[model samples]
Target: MAGTEGIDITRRNKKPRLLTDAERDQLDEFVDSIHYSSRYNDDHYEYRHVQLPKAMLKKIPKEYFDGGRGTLKLLWEDEWRGLGITQSLGWEHYEVHEPEPHILLFK
Candidate 1:
């Protein structure tokens, strides 16, 4: 018997993973609910997922420091936030200390 190849295999088998009707509807709703804001010329209502590295933690600027104690102090002084310290959304990996809002995304 000759082994299947190219389009023959695709025609014989269906995708292993498939989204249900409800799941597809929910995804459509999520995509339609996005809204844009004019405050900063950025769409504040978009959803994004990103992961940062430990070495890039030293790039946060010195303005969004909040001027408080604890981890904030370390970030303000050294411009680097210690790993496994606190849970901050705006500054997930590194403490953001700059006035202008900045976001970094990696593909």
Candidate 2:
């Protein structure tokens, strides 16, 4: 299938599964309740990120990335909608939603 005889050219990279309706709602609720005050918050810096379940992405065991970490990972809390990020930093918020199926939001 390729320059090599045994290579499976048909094989494709893993892709991210989209967020379910329920998950999306839950994330939104949290963003509103935690990131923003009922009235308004001028200090908030909202950022959106999509961290798919590990199973949805490629498994590079013992590797942070095949290459070096990028800006996205630096922002990626890998937690629930960036709650972990807030613990350390302020005025920053994010949402890590699952991408559309086969979309592969991350490398």
lDDT of each: 0.26, 0.28
The TM-score, computed over Cα atoms with residue i paired to residue i, of candidate 2 is 0.21
- Give the winner by TM-score: 2
What tens digits encode model 2's per-residue C-alpha lDDT throughout 24-91? 54444333333222223234333232334333233221222223222122122233232211333332
Instruction: Compute each candidate's TM-score over C-alphas.
Output: 0.19, 0.21
Best by lDDT: 2
Each model's total of backbone clashes = 3, 1
Model 1 per-residue lDDT tens digits across residues 1-107: 11122112221113222334543443342333222222222332222322233232243223322334212221211121221222233431222223322322111
| Total clashing pairs in model 2 | 1
Q: What is the alpha-carbon lDDT for the whole of candidate 2?
A: 0.28
Location of the lowest summed lDDT over 10 successive residues in candidate 2: 98-107
